[model samples]
Target chain A: MNAQFKKGVLDLCVLAQLAKGDKYGYELTETISQEMTVATGTLYLLLRRLNEEGYFETYLVETPGGPARKYYRLTPKGLAYTQSLKDEWITFIDQVNRLIR
Target chain B: MNAQFKKGVLDLCVLAQLAKGDKYGYELTETISQEMTVATGTLYLLLRRLNEEGYFETYLVETPGGPARKYYRLTPKGLAYTQSLKDEWITFIDQVNRLIR
Candidate 1:
């Protein structure tokens, strides 16, 4: 994968994952790394940026099995943003599919 | 479309377009804007970044039909980079497709 491409999509991918449920930084990094490669530092940086952008809000939450985790959840703005991304992706892929065929 | 998604995809999209042939800044912006919205200033900034990264090399070429234009084409590194991006995109979309179904 292109590092630049990965850099670009990491934020949105993180958002998509968080939209399903609140997740702590490490857990989010672990999940995304399973599907695509990303560094822990990079993930943290992106998370901070998204939080700063108001796409997400985070707070400390205690887990039954472990230490308190900094859980992250999407803001209303994030959900709306994800929907728009989904639409654009569908359109872009449709065009690419045609070209490939 | 998601501005963030657009931000992510724009570089790949621009590279893909240039892979077809060399083009100037304005033409690339106009072409992409037909399918996706992007500001001219953003396009130039991205172009500078890509050029700085050595993904592309640019030179001014005089056109018989008009003024000299700054044409951009992929370097060998850029082509390799684009190939990597394509592979990642395919894998990512395949997963997304399965989830959609």
Candidate 2:
């Protein structure tokens, strides 16, 4: 897949995944990477930016064998942003499909 | 639609448009912008880049009362690039749809 195209939708993927359930940094990166070839480094940077933007809030959860895990949860703003982007995504793909087909 | 998402597909959009038929700069922008909100200025810049990258070839078509219009047609490279990107587009969107849905 095109790198730029993947970058465009990366935020949505992260947001939607969190909407399903909260996941820690490594866990979130793993889930997204399973679906696409995104670099964990890139995902970390994006996660920081999204958290700073108030779209996501992070909390620390203690693990039995390791240090606390930093998990991300969607804020209200994030949910609203995801919904709007999801709607736009449908329309955008439909328009491109029309022209390409 | 997200501007970044639009930017990611803009190259494919232009290439796909040329694959349909030859079009001058203004005419191509007009056609694409009708389906989606793209700035003509941005389209012109992309046309120049694609032409420079050898994906597009240009010709001059003289009009009766107006200046000769510079037209763009998909080159062999452009066609191949479009096909590859189109294939990638299908898979990419499918992956994203799976995650979001």
The candidate scoring highest on TM-score is: 2
Among incorrect, acceptable, medium and high, the docking class of model 2 is acceptable
Over the stretch B1-101, how does candidate 1's per-residue lDDT look in tens digits? 12233235567778888878888998988887766556799889999999999999899988899788899989999988877766666777765543322
Cα-based lDDT at residue B71, candidate 1 = 90
Error of 2 at B65 (Å): 3.5
- Which ranges in model 2 have alpha carbons more than 4 Å from their true place? A1-7, B1-7
Cα-based lDDT for every prediction: 0.73, 0.80
lDDT of candidate 1 at residue B55, scale 0 to 100: 95
- Model 2 residue A80 CA deviation in Å: 1.7
**List of chain B TM-scores, one per candidate:** 0.82, 0.88
Candidate 2 structure lDDT = 0.80
User: Individual DockQ of the candidates?
Assistant: 0.12, 0.34
lDDT by residue for model 2 (B1-101), tens: 22233246877788888888998999878877767877778888989988899998889999999899999988898999888878777877877887888
Task: State the DockQ, from 0 to 1, for candidate 1.
Answer: 0.12
